[model samples]
Target: MEVLVNNKLYAVQQGITIAALLQFIQLSAHKGIAVAVNNQVVPKTAWDQQQVEPADNITIIRATQGG
Candidate 1:
């Protein structure tokens, strides 16, 4: 299956969860991050349950320490 992540197309396995996707892309889940699917913010508690569908739009925003 393919999904649009941050406007880029990525091929991922079907039934992949947000948590798995993050790991697949080598993102640091330990850090503060925000995930949104199809314009809806997905709470951290739901990452393990949020499944990515084909053509779904996923946005990952990681917190930065600059001000």
Candidate 2:
């Protein structure tokens, strides 16, 4: 299946959870990361349980430590 990540299309396995996707993307340390699915923000506590649907719009943002 294909899902939109940060406005770009990326192929992913079916039934992939947000937590899995983050790991696949190599975000080993996601302390400052935030995710949204289909325009709705998903709390960090739900990443492991939130499954990505086909064509779902997923956005991931991470905080940087620069002023």
Write down the TM-score of every candidate.
0.93, 0.91
Quote the lDDT for 10 in model 2: 87
Tens digits of per-residue lDDT for model 2 on 1-67?
9999988888999999999998987875779999999889999999999899999999899998987
The segments of candidate 2 whose C-alpha lies over 4 angstroms from its true place after superposition are none
| Best prediction by TM-score | 1
lDDT of 1 by residue, 1-67 (tens): 9999898899999999999999988884547889999999999999889899999999999888987
C-alpha RMSD for every candidate:
1.0, 1.0
The reply for model 1, stretches above 4 Å from the true place, is: none
